[model samples]
Target: MADIVVRRVDLGYFVRPASETGTEHARVEPTLGYLIEHPIGLVLVDTGMGRHPEVDAHYRPRRIPLTAALRTAGAKLDDIEYVVNCHLHFDHCGGNPELAGRPVFTQRSELSLARTTEHTIPELIDHPGARYEELDGEAEILPGVVIVPTPGHTAGHQSVVVTRRDGTIVVAGQSHDNASLFTGDVLSQRAGVGHHPVWIDRLLAFDPRQVVFAHDNAVWTPGTSQVSAS
Candidate 1:
């Protein structure tokens, strides 16, 4: 397999309501998506924020429409061959409708919740041309790209693992919200001191060269000396 390129798609930002964040003051977070340029085809991870009056009033999202975002990433909507939504949250799968007919890979459990519960925007999940390829668990959607369950933010949340000649990259969409949180989890796992997700071990096994997140711009790299949160 040829070396794959993972490009960050800036979906824009949003302000989290204080009540929802459990913080005294609302916090601002970036909504990001990833585009994996593979030899076989392009795979998009997470769309942008979905529109809803109540959600808008709560999140106060400043969205960069999916088309524009993809353009900035050096691609177009029509160029995307497959879609992998880390989870079906409104902010994550917002642009799913646009890529209808393309196989949108999602966890079966996540799809069930998104359909039966008030999980995400209804239309985003079951649009006119929506085509979902629900997976029961971990599956390799591409030659060197694997989707592993990383539930926490959501029950069926997952992350993408891309292995290149140099090293591995994990697109941990909202897996830990930010790179710092993910780093802390890694540190905790190392020292065996605090609670961390079981899937953290799975990700660690990959020894990722860099880990990116959906809500934070920072990237997590190995080594405490090389750790970068800014």
Candidate 2:
């Protein structure tokens, strides 16, 4: 079997506030994910920014070009076989139309909250692909890929564990949007204390070769893997 490989595709879209980085835009291009060589074929972690810039520009979504992001990775929407949402935030699921009829795996609780969170932006939840198979509970999506429940950022928020031929890596969607958070920054779970200490413990217990986060500009390469970034 060709070992599973992971890539962090910077689908340059939104950024943090200027106060955070001091640059004119002071933003970051959030990354989408690619989990390769899994038994169920290929899986795209999140669909980057969707097509709603005009609708929510006045509010607060600083988006980049998603089409260009995918192009950099040498991928088209059709290349993704299955889609897994860390959570259904607008920026994350925007690219789901790449496979309108395909199944997107999500948590029922997260979907419910996404639908009725009241305070969340409505545009994020109004996707045409919400008919996803709501995760009943923790289980495997592929022989080597398992979805681990890591609540706190949002109910039913989960991460994927890709067990490759060499070592395992955990795609912690929002668990650690950046390395600083996982390394102990109080602001780690910025989406509202949605992170639990237990989840990190469990994830590390598995001893991942690397930790990939959804919105960060960096990656943590474990001392163990030659193939992963340190």
Q: Candidate 2 on 1-230: residue-level lDDT in tens?
A: 56666766666556566665556666554555554545457677887665555535533555545556655666666667788888877667767765676678888898888878753446546556544877976778878888888887787889988887678888888875676556553233223465546666667667776777887656666442223233
Candidate 2 regions exceeding 4 Å error are 18-29, 51-67, 119-126, 185-196, 223-230
Q: Per-residue alpha-carbon lDDT of model 1 for 1-230, expressed as tens digits?
A: 67999999999999988887887989999999999999999999999999999889888999999999999999999999999999998999999989989999989999998998876889888999999899988899999999999998889899999999899999999898778788888988999998999999999899899999999989899978145653
Error of 2 at 123 (Å): 5.9
Residue 13 accuracy (lDDT) in model 2: 50
- Candidate 1, residue 106: the lDDT equals 89
lDDT of each: 0.92, 0.67
* Model 1 bad stretches (over 4 Å): 225-230
Worst 10 residues of 2 by lDDT: 221-230
Q: Please, what is the TM-score per model?
A: 0.97, 0.77
